[model samples]
Target: MPSTRSQVDTLESGLPYDYTDDEFDPDYRESSEEEEDEVPKTMQRDRAKWIEDNVEDIEFLYRQLMRDGRSMFGDSFLQTGTINTFANFLYRNTTPFSEA
Candidate 1:
């Protein structure tokens, strides 16, 4: 075990913020656990909200891509023959509705 005189000196120096050797007990552990448990509920709610918003944005982008792609490619680019035609079709479909 460490010397009490060194521990007292360390405490007096205030080098460890609010912590000290004397404060370490079962009650401290229980309080820390309770604080930790409180965090997950808030984090889970934020995560769920973030996922919901992202899913909505993704769906919107998918629908927009489908609509604009069909318009630019005439819905029959896949059926067309020749590499040039397919290349032109691909190039034409490259421009998305959103600039950014």
Candidate 2:
């Protein structure tokens, strides 16, 4: 019979994983990896045009009442989803909000 500790280790090892270093990929993370790895060959040719079409950045800030004056950056990147959401917000930002 397997003990709790052994069962936990088995479950943990079977769980799944993905990283830039992974040679083979699981179906779930494969598509995402492709998107991040290749940004369309056409875009790579022209730096300005490429950046204009695909959103990108290094820093961000949220002026919301709760998180007022707060900011985000590459180091603050929690994960792919979080970074994507914040980056999208910054890309579309046109004006700042005030707490007053």
Candidate 3:
């Protein structure tokens, strides 16, 4: 059994005394690479499904904004320059329209 102090040290360090640096190990690297390859396909499919499910709500919000003649951002929301700037900002900063 580990002493209380040793357990505390392990918790503080966020690692066990017997922990090996598997990152540099070839077997570990190969398994991680396989995981990485599988991750993107799953992520993309999930993202697409989320977008599909929410698209109607998104469109409804846009229509409401247009009908009310109110810009959620500000009074200048309808201006082309403001729209361009906002679009550019969103494109640069957001991931897959999530931020907007």
Candidate 4:
């Protein structure tokens, strides 16, 4: 385990401002299991509208960061192609998607 000083120093680096409150809960980091729970009708129905308002700005920042990160390392498309081939190998061996 890391020492407390190292963990506390993480905040001095300036975390991204767009980090969501939803991710704070360990349960909803993301969901892949059956979401049997339904949203109550009383809740605001404009949730999609709210997300639409900001998603583009969020995506723009994400793309900028990715671009800057790539420039810093000077990586090549071959790196992605190699990863895709490896993923295909794993998926083909493990799932019916390969047969289709």
Candidate 5:
């Protein structure tokens, strides 16, 4: 029977770990190989076009935010749904927020 120390030492990870210096070295990677692993850049659409397309929804949401602010500021709290909707709108409009 193995001792606790021996049992612990013999436990298998089953992953390849005994790589040679040359095998997993970064210098061995070709430029193309590194490039292939990189994330591709996404193109930005026109904000004006986005606003134009989503005008009704955006205006409705913006009005709701403003109304809530006017009536609730220091008087009442906003619902989590309202805050989440605003946050999600900001998240989706990345280019506009990133510039700010």
Candidate 6:
């Protein structure tokens, strides 16, 4: 049976000790990769349009979530439901735009 110290040493050896290298830094990503990942103008326009269309609904939900602590709804209830709705809204909007 392995001793606890040896097991811990093995685990530590498998982990990265330094993250300063380029491979671990997002800002060090190659220029070509950045270019390939850039969103097209049309897609950007579509995303902007989608946001504009949903701005009112987003604002309304946000206001409800930002209400004073004395409101009838509990913080947990408001946070959970509002955040879930916002996430769902983003996911639904992304599907159409992303596939285009």
Q: Which candidate is the best by TM-score?
A: 6
**Which pairs clash in model 1?**
none
Q: Candidate 5 lDDT, tens digit per residue, 40-96?
A: 233224444555676677767777776877686743645443533553355455544
lDDT of 1 by residue, 1-94 (tens): 8766633434556675455554676566434633432324434455445445556554565556566767998776444344333332333344
Instruction: Give the better candidate number (3 or 6) by lDDT.
Output: 6
Model 6 vs. true fold: TM: 0.36
TM-scores, all candidates, are 0.24, 0.22, 0.27, 0.26, 0.32, 0.36
Q: RMSD for all candidates, in order, please.
A: 20.6, 11.8, 13.0, 17.1, 12.0, 8.8
Q: What tens-digit string does per-residue lDDT give for candidate 3 at 1-100? A: 8666633435556775554677767776444633422324435565556546656665565556555665556666555433323333333344463321
Model 1: residues with Cα > 4 Å off, grouped in runs: 1-53, 76-100
Give the RMSD in angstroms, all C-alphas superposed, for model 5. 12.0
Ranking by TM-score: 6, 5, 3, 4, 1, 2
Candidate 2 stretches greater than 4 Å from native: 1-32, 47-58, 61-100
Better of 2 and 6 by lDDT: 6
| Clash tally for model 2 | 0
For candidate 2, the per-residue lDDT at 29 reads: 50
TM-score of 2: 0.22
2 or 4, greater by lDDT: 4
Ranking by lDDT: 6, 5, 3, 1, 4, 2
| Steric clashes per prediction | 0, 0, 0, 0, 0, 0
The worst-scoring run of ten residues by lDDT in candidate 3 lies at: 83-92
**Residue 69 of candidate 4: its Cα lDDT?**
65
| lDDT, candidate 4, 1-100, per-residue tens | 8666644423556864455766786776564322312233432243334335656654565556557767886665235433323333333444442333
Report the lDDT of model 1 for residue 90. 37
Winner by lDDT: 6
**In model 5, where do residues sit more than 4 Å from their true spots?**
1-45, 74-100
